[model samples]
Target: MRFLSKKDVPFKEVVPDGYIDIHSHLLPGIDDGVKTIYQSGYILEQFENFGFKKVITTPHIMQDIWPNSSQTITSNLKKLKDVLVPLGITKIELRASAEYMMDDLFYERIKNNDILPLHQNYILVEMSTFAPPINLNEILFEIKLAGYIPILAHPERYSFYHDDLKKYDELKASGFLFQVNLLSISGYYGEQIKSFAKKMIDQGYIDFTGTDVHNYHQLEVLEKGFEFKIAKKITSLMKNNIEFS
Candidate 1:
């Protein structure tokens, strides 16, 4: 099947049907995503129109920046749901989780079991784009020991690991699943990240794909991503996302 960009066709016809988006910042006034209930409602409506059956929106839980907890996420999720219900946008299942930054605070949360996992035990994680954390392996080990599956969000966007692609292989071997962002295939983050995303796809390293939608602009880019050749290929291999949905 051929995929068309939002510009080439209608924006609603961009992504393939039945896509279950597992990572996005759709909750209002929480993180770096939509700022108001209106924005959240609009994005969720767009997701429904775009043919998504479910979307597990993951807000950022960085200590210094967002500092969100499970309670905060759940509360905001309830608020968003309340607003959406009035708009009659209830067919698409909207759930909340957190994309945890691998930092000292995250380690504490893990110990305290204060995490909002996606689905059962799938915890989404990310690192600083400039560098990997000193205790990455240790944290991964602990996550496994605690019986939670660690999913590394957008591994291709970390420029530090671009030169050393084998790190992806190592992480995969260590049981860390990889989730690639859809816009990366459209070169939204630059050619380097796009190249890495292609390499990961070609190597069959990506376990899932997400929109990582922050706003309407990012959503536009995500719509364009469907036109990229890699998008079609990666969509076929997103078994992990499908099973999670």
Candidate 2:
């Protein structure tokens, strides 16, 4: 028997039933995310319309910048939920976690057990686009020692690692899970990011996919980017996000 031909379908059209989004910046006024309660509501509403069953909004926790704590993130999530319920945008479940910037403060947080995980024992972390920390390996070791699984967020967006593909191997071998930003795959950041994202996906380096959506425009681009055939490759990994649910 001949194999059935595959169709190039828009990602939005074939989104896995009850697809859960693992990362987004839908919290208002906490970080560089939506910024307002109304903005949060609007984004969540759009997420529901896009067929997302759940969203774990991971706000930035950069020192002296976002500096968000679990208290702050939970409070903002409550505020967003309060507004969303009133607006009748409650189809999607909303949870708050933090995208921690690996730094001295982060190391301290790990020691203090001060972290909000995406799920049990899984904390989301990111490196600066400028460079990986000199003690990046040390931090990963500490994170694992603390019984937390360190998931490196948006590894493809870290342009510093793009030219050094072996670094990706080293990171994975070190037991760090990878989360690729859908916006990167969508070419929103640039062709370079999109290309690297596809390459990583092809290499089976990415374990999960996240929207990493900071605003409406990014979400739009992410949706359109799914129209490409390469986007189909991510649909399986998208199922991996339901682990967060």
Candidate 3:
């Protein structure tokens, strides 16, 4: 597996007064994120220190791999809230949501309303970078029919779309919004992904930005990326909205 590194990534100098990091696997003891409530508290503190005012913490809801359910996510989020109450560090507002996987199981699960919705009927979804889902269009259509909007997470990272940037255009044309990972542009994912992020923005296709911070190491890499001019200019847009559904 190709893990993103901090050495190849750069940071920005100027951070906005407020930021909204909509992507993260912050729910502890579940997937690959904070291990305990204490670590969760520390990560929230780091978000405040980094100038973000809101965090729409999104945990993975991939059935085959992560196998996370709404009950599991809600339970962990409740514990996280309990831990943060006494800290008196309320500068950052934390909200819970899930990044869903677009597969057959998800396709049916979504119809039954067994998923947690993010930011007003929007469900954050990720596809296998190895290949586009065979029933991609139909699944998206079903999500829309279910009265939910879909935001494809980190579209540029999917290697299958590398040869065809219009694959993203097709998604946009079909009415799905794209929320990019800030680390991708910072070269935390790779040079190719970083360049693709730039291209997406230049094409005016990016609608949102997120830290996608899973642990302290990712935060450190993101911190470095914040120092670069190009990355900073784009990341500064993450603060666009707060207090969403």
Candidate 4:
């Protein structure tokens, strides 16, 4: 019997039409994502081709590094939109939000009600891959108190939790929604992350999925990932993103 290769599978087969993309870093120049308006347009055009109906492009809001505010994200989003119209890349609807790093700054933002929500008061959040914040529970409590649903970005990538799988269950019990990265299932981050992603899916912990695309290289990798055997499991979660639409 001839086994099919990953190249034989296409990304469109996994993601359906009118699918809503809940995470990405397509905003140009504000973070580590696409560097210019042109690059942003290129990624969006690819998103359009991949059957994404809308993309909620999230830029990093790490206080020490990116420090992007609602004003900054909104401004760059407008700049990207203006360029996209000229590039004829208007098929996919675009919106802006922040992948907030859970730090002191984020706590303050929660207190001040200064936040850019993804949709319907849901906010995408991330913690250090090295270690979660010492005051994580407090931050999560504040997030809920502020009326924002906290969706943890790429839960499988957190190395600290890899050893203690029950931490995932604790997080779920705490009302944290998990967004697994599409690339992780493709083994783009590494075998460890890839395995964890699969495990998360098996446990039914993944609430949503995202490309988390930062550059052209990653985007290409994302396309190739569709060919992986695990892509079938990831496809099931892809439909969940439309809730944000």
Which candidate comes out best when scored by TM-score?
A: 4
Where's the lowest-lDDT run of ten residues in candidate 3? 5-14
**Per-model CA lDDT versus the true structure:** 0.83, 0.84, 0.78, 0.89
Of 2 and 4, the candidate ahead on lDDT is 4
lDDT (Cα, tens digit) per residue for candidate 2, span 105-171: 8998998888898899999999899989999888988898889998999999888878888999999
Candidate 2, TM-score vs. the true structure? 0.93
Candidate 1 lDDT over 167-228, as tens digits, reads 87788899899899877876788878887788888988888888899999987776654444
For each candidate, give its TM-score against the true structure.
0.92, 0.93, 0.89, 0.96
Show the lowest summed lDDT stretch of 10 residues, model 4: 225-234
Clashing pairs in 1: none
Deviation in Å, model 1, residue 189 alpha carbon: 0.9
How does model 1 score by TM-score? 0.92
Worst 10 residues of 2 by lDDT: 2-11
Tens digit of per-residue lDDT, candidate 3, span 36-153: 7777888888788877778889888776678888898888888888878697657888888888889877888888988788777877999888998999888987898889988889
For residues 86-175, could you state the per-residue lDDT of candidate 4 as single tens digits? 899878999999999999999999999999999998999999988999999999999999988999999999999888988988998998
The order by descending lDDT is 4, 2, 1, 3
Best of the two (3, 4) by TM-score: 4
